[model samples]
Each structure stands twice: as structure tokens, then as C-alpha cells.
Target: MLIGDVARHSGVSTRMLRHYDALGLVRPTGRTVGGYREYSAEDVRRIFHVESLRSLGLTLKQIGRALEDPDFTPSALVGDLIRWTEERLEREQELLERLRAVDASAPTGWQDVLRIVELMQGLDSTSAARRQQAVLTRPEGVPVPAELLAAAVLAESDPLVAGALRWALARSGGDGVAALTAGARSEDVDVRRRAVLAIAGTAEAPGAAAVLADALGDPDPTVRGHAALASGRRGVTAAVPVLVGMVVEGSHDVEAAEILGTLSQDPGCAERILAALTGELAAPTADSATRIRLTQALVELSGDTGREALRRLARDDDRAVALVASAFVAVLDERSPEVPGAEVP
Candidate 1:
């Protein structure tokens, strides 16, 4: 077959076939009587082989060696090609993700595009300070997309950077609530914990409360604790049980107690708080140390109910509990005179 015929039959471009001939990668076996290049059957087969190697990302030089070097084993070269292809694919995937983020931001100009790109790079920086600064220094007009902030907040490991990212997400007007809520369902407990924490900061956002309400049921105790605290601050009564549990378990128990006290100001919440604590205090399985912690938490409660509860606990059989509750009752008595109509029992 002639060069044109080989090009036509093999689907290889004539120019590329000429380049392959120049590189000694492929050459016609003979010439026609008219002085045209004539490809024998073996040359045509080599052309197909070269094209096949090219499809596997082999350079022309590598293909030449592959065909000519009898000592060259393809296993090592194929493995290297696989690695190179993987690296290229990774780069392409990263570029695609960046492009998708930019497209999602709906940038109005080059400046907006650049700002988003810069923020993304900053968020991905190895330095925690850089990540924090990325969130803290977000330009006023060129807002970081809520989705980007949500992802960063979920993945952020540094406490300071995570706080900054959560603040940024909150300022996004709960636009990233869907993304954050998705994170809350992650199999990764840390991701779910970060998700709930970020959502908690978005309390002012429209759907943040509902998302937190849903998060309160998360199986991860950390997730539930954050949701309970944030929801409690927002006056969600549904968080009462979790808050009470936090107090008993000594996980942010002080904050939990304070919030419980605040919630206790509502019509019937005080009785519930009192009942819950008293139940924990009265549990036969609760050790003396556990009872002491719960006793300390009672001081955080509001109204005569908490004071009176302490008064009852002051006489408990557990000496540590009695001593702590008695001491607290004494402090309450000393402070009672400061209030105009306060009665100390």
C-alpha cells in the first residue's frame, strides 16, 4: 500500500505518518515503480501498533524504543505510564473542580473570579493562619461562596481557622445550609461535628435553626452536644434533654447548666430541669463523684426552685454532695439579703 493508502486505511494522519517515518518509528518497506513510498503488510501492522501505543500515552520516542528495543520490557514502562496518566488525571480533576466552584460563584468580572480563586487557594493552604485569614479577610463585595466556606469549615482541623470559617459561613445568610446539613450526615464523626458547629453559628440564618434541630438527633454525641448548645441559645425547648445530659456528663457542663438555667425561666421548664437533675442525683447507679458534679450544676439554675433543690440536696446521704450543696445553699443565703424581697430558707 502507498503512504496515502496506509494513512487512509489506518486512520493515521499523513503528516503524522511522515513524522513517524522521520523518527524511525515506522518506515515503508519499499517504493512503488513511480517512486512513491510503498508500505508492506508488516509496515502497516507496525503503524497500527504505533497508533495503539500512542493511545496509551506513549511519546513517539518511547514508542520507537518500544518497537525497536528487543530488551525493553513493557511492564516497567506501562507502570510508569499508568502513574503519569494518574497524575495528569488528578490535575485535570482538580482543575475541573476549581472551574466548577468558580462557575457556581457566578462571578460578575475578572476581579470576582480572581478573588474566588485566591480565597480557595488560601483556604487550602498548609498554614492555619493563612486559612483563618482567608475567611477573616474575605473582601466585602466579592463574597466567598457559601458552599466553598461550608466545605472548608467541614474539613478545617485547626480550631481557630474553623471558627473563622464558621463565622464566614454564618455571614453568608445560611446559603450554605444545605451543604452544611449534608456534612452533618457524613459518616466521618469529625465532619459531622464541624458541620453542626458551623450550623450553630448560623443561628441568625433562616433555616439554621431547623438544620440544628435535625442535627440534635445525630448519633455522634459531639454533634448532638453542639446542636443542643446552639439550639438552647436559640431557645429551642427540644434541646432540653440533651443539655441536661451534657450537664450530667460534664461535657461543657457549665455552659449547659447556664443555658438550662436560662431555659428554666420559662413557665414549666424549671420544673423539668429540676426533675431531670433530681432524677440523675437519685439514680442508684450514679457514683458519689457523679452526684457531686450534678449537684454543682444545680447552682446554675434560676428561681427559688434551684435554691430549694439545693436545700433538699444539702441533707443528702452522700457527704460530698451534701457538703457542696450545703456550701452553695450558704452562698445563696448570704447573697439573698442583696435582693429586696428575697427569702432565704
Candidate 2:
């Protein structure tokens, strides 16, 4: 076949076929009487082979080595191609995400588009300071997409940066709640923990309280603790059980107790609080340390029920428990001058 016929048959352009010949990638392998380049069947086959390799993102130089290097093995080259393709895909995905964020913002002009792009780049920066600044300085009215913020919050390992991201998410008015809620369900414990914390920070958002209430049941104690603390502060009665449990477990028990004390302002909650503490105090399996923490937690409760509980605990058989409880009872008695006759059991 002549060059024209070869081009027509192979669908490889004539210019490209000539370029391939010049590079000695697929020489004609014959010359016609008129001296025009002529291709044998093998030459056409080589052209198709080059096109096939190009489809795999192989550069012309790489293709040449693949075709002509007798010692070349595909293992290393294929691995390199895979890496390059993956890198390209990641870049493309990132670009797509940025475009989506811009579109979501409904940018008014090129400047808004540029600002969003800059903010995204800053958020993804390796420097924690840059990421923090990105969140701290997020321009108002140019909303950063909640999904992006939630993903960053979940992955951020720096405490300062993570805190700022959480604040930013909260400022976005619970827009990130759905994303953070998804994060709360992540299999990664750290991710779940972060999700709950972010959700708690956003508790002021319209639906954030409900999301936190849902998070209260997370299996991860850390997640549950955060959710309980936030929800308890928000007066979500659903967190009562978990807050009581934290006191018994001695996990952030101090904060839990404080929040529980606030929750106890409700007469019904006070009864439940006292009952939960009394039950934990009487549990034979309660470790000495756990019992001590639970006893101390009672001091944070309001009303005489807690003081009376402390007084009863003061006479318990466990010397250490009795000593701590006795001290707290004395303190409570001294603070309430009206109880002049109050004494440790």
C-alpha cells in the first residue's frame, strides 16, 4: 500500500505516518518505482501498534523504547504509566471539585471564581498555618462548599487547624452538617471523633442539635462523649444517659458532670441523675477509681440530694471512697451556712 492508501486504511493521518517514518518508528519498508514511500503489511501493523500504545498515555519516546528496545520489559514502564495516569486522574478530580465549588458559590464574576480557587488551594496547603488562614479569612457571602470543609475537618490532624476548620464549618450555618454527619458514621475512629466534634461546634445551627442527638449513640466512646457534652449543653435530654455513663466511665467526667448539673435544673432530670449516680455507686463491680470519680462528680450536682448522697457515701466501707466523700460532704456543709447541724456520717 502507498502512503495515501495506508493512511486511508489505517486511519493514522498521513502527516503522523510520515512523522513516525522520520523517527524510524514505522518505516515504509519499501520504495515504489516513482520513489514514493510504500508500506508493507508489517509496516501498517507497526503503525496500529504505535497508536495502541499511545492510547495508554505513552509518550512518543516511551513508545519508541517499547517498540524497539529488545531488553525493555513492560513491568517498569507499565508501572510508571499507571502512576502517571493516577496522578493525572487525581489532578482532574481536584479540578472538577474546585469547579463544582465555584459553581455552587454562584460566583458573580471572575474575581469570585479566583477567590474560591485561592481559598481551596489554601485549604489544601501543606502548611497548617495556610490551611488555618484559609478558614479564618474565608470571605463572607462567598460560601465555601460544606462538603469541602467537612472533608478537610475530618482529615486535619493539627489541633489548631482542625479547630479553625470546625469554626468555619459552624459559621457556614450547618451547611456542613450533612457532610459531618456522614463523617460521624465513618469507619475510622478518628474520623468519627472529628465528625462529632465538628457537629458539636455547629450545634447552634438549625438542625445541628438533631445531628448531635443522633451522634450520641455512636459506638466510639470518644464520639459519644463529644456528642453528649455538646448535646447536654444544648439541653438535649437525650444526652442524659450518655453523660451519666461518662461519669461512671471517668471519661471527661468533669465536663460531663458540669453539663449534667445544668441538665438537672429540670426536676425530672435531677431525679434521673441522682438515681444513675446512686446505682453506679452501689454496683459491686464498680472499680475503686471509677467509684471515686463518680463520687466527685456528685459534688457538681445541685440540691440536697447530691449532698445527702455524699453523706451516705462518707460512711461506706471503702476507706478511700469514704475519705473523698467525707471531704466533699464537709465542703458542701461549710458552703451552706444554713446547714449548721450538717455533719459527715
Candidate 3:
């Protein structure tokens, strides 16, 4: 076939076919009667092969080697192509995210757009100080949208920067809550933990309570523990069981115990907290330290149930527990006549 015919039949532009010939990638070996360059069937086949490999993100150089180099294996080259494609996709996704954030901010002019972009760059900076500065900007400054801060906080690894991001997010008037709720469902454990911590700081925001309730059931104990403490402080009765469990595990047990004490303000809640604590106290895993922490927690409780439990522990088989409990019982009796139980918040 003539080159023009090959171009017409194969749908390759004649210009590209000439380029391929010059590169020795697909030179037609046959000559027409007019002595013009002509494509043989095999040459046409090679042209189609190059196009096929090119569609798989192969560079022209790589495709040339794939077709001409007999020893060239495809596995490593295909893996490279995959990696390159993945990197490209990641960059595109980041660009898209930036665009979405800018659009969400609803910039009214180029200056507003520039300010939003600057804040985003600051938040994404390698220096934690820069990121924190972005978050700590005064409200009258860049006017960065809440979603941007929410995204930054979810991914922030530096404790100082993360705290600042959370602090900024808390004052977004609940604008950050939706992003935070999605973050709470992240597969990354650290991301979920950060999301829960942010939610805790923003608990006064609308929808914060429901998200906190959901986080209480998270498989990561740290996530669940914070959720429990936050929710317990919010007076959600659901946090009672986990707060008691925190006392047993000694993970933030003091805070957990204190929150438990606060939750005990409800007369019915007092009985529940008392029962859960006493139940753990009776468990085989209740070590002396566990019992003592639980004891101090019991003392923080409001009703006579705490004092009553202390009186029983005064005779605990563990000598140390008995002494501590006996001492606490005496203190409780002395303070009991002097002050009434704390009023429920």
C-alpha cells in the first residue's frame, strides 16, 4: 500500500507516519512501482502495535524499545507506567481539591482568590509553624473557608499544628462539622483519631454530639476513649459504659473517672455508674491499682452508692485496698455531714 493509502486506511496522520519512519520505528520495506516509499502488511501491523502500546501511557521511546528490543520485558515497564499514572492522578486530585476549596470560599475577586490560595499554601506548608500560622490567622485576615481548615486538621500530624487547626475549626460556626464527620469515617487510624479530637474541641457545634456518639464505638481505643469523655461531659448516657471501661484500662483513667463522677449527677446515672464501677471492682482482672483508681473514681461519685461501695471495700481482701478504702470511707463520712452532694449540671 502507498503511504497515503496506509495513512488513510490505518487512520494515522501521514505526518506521524513519516515521523515514525524517520525514527526507524515503522519504516515501510516495500517499494511501489513509482519508487515511492510503500508499506508492506508487516509494516502496517507494527504501526498498529505502536499505537496500541502508546494508549497504555507508554512514552514513544518506551514503545519503540518495546517493539524493537527483543530482551525488553514488559513487567518492569508496565509497573513504571502504572506508577507514573498514579502520580499524575494524585496531582490532579490535589489540584481538584484546591479548586473545590477555592470555589467553596466563593471568592469575589482575584485578590480574594489570591488570599485563599495563600492560606491554603500556608496550611500545606512543610513547616508546622507555617501551618499553625495559617490556622491562627485573625478572623479579619484571609477569610479562609472552614472546609480548608477542616481538611488541614484531619491530616495534621504535628500536635501543635493539629491543636491550632482544631481550635480554628471549633469557631467555624459548625461549618467544619460535615468535613470532620467524613474524616471520622476515614480508614486511616491517625486521621480518625485527629477527627475525633477536633470534634471533641468543637462539641458545642451543631451535629457534634451525634458524631461524638458515633466515635464512641470506634475500634481504636484512643478514639473511643476521647469520644466517651467528650460525650460524658455532654451528658450523653451512652458514654457511661466506656468511661467505666477507661478506668479499668488505665487509659486516661483519671479524666475518665472524673467524667464518670460528673455523669453520676443524674440520680439514675449515679446508680448506673456505681454498678458498673462495683462490677469491675468485683471482676477477676481488677488489680490493686485498678481497684484503687476505681476507688478514687468512686469517691468522685455523688450518691451514697459511692460511700456504700467504699464501706464494703474497707474490708477488701487486699490489705492495701482495705486501708485505702477505709481511709476514704472516713473522709467521706467527715465531708458528707459538712456538704451536700453536688447539684447536677
Q: Give a tens-digit lDDT track for model 1, residues 1-345.
A: 988889899999899888988888888888888988899999999999998999999998898898888999999999999999999999999888788888888899999999999999998899999988877888897756677888898899999999888777777753877778888888999999998888787776777888898888888878899999999998888999899888777799889988988888896888888899989988888888788878887887776667877877888887788899989988877776434554433
Ranking by lDDT: 2, 3, 1
lDDT of 2 by residue, 29-92 (tens): 9998999999999988999999999998898889999889999899998899899989999999
- Which pairs in model 3 have colliding backbones? none
Any idea what lDDT model 1 has?
A: 0.85
The C-alpha RMSD of each candidate to the native structure, in angstroms, is 3.5, 2.8, 4.2
lDDT by residue (tens digit), candidate 3, 1-345? 888999998899999999998888889997878888889899999999999998999988888998878999999988988999999999999999999888987778898888888888888789998888876774464456688888888888999998888877766553787888899999999999999988888787789899999998999999998799889888898999999989999999999888888888899889989999999999997899999989888998975669877877887899888888888877877776623553211
Model 1, poorest ten-residue lDDT window? Answer: 336-345
| Model 2 RMSD in angstroms | 2.8
Question: Higher lDDT: candidate 1 or 2?
Answer: 2
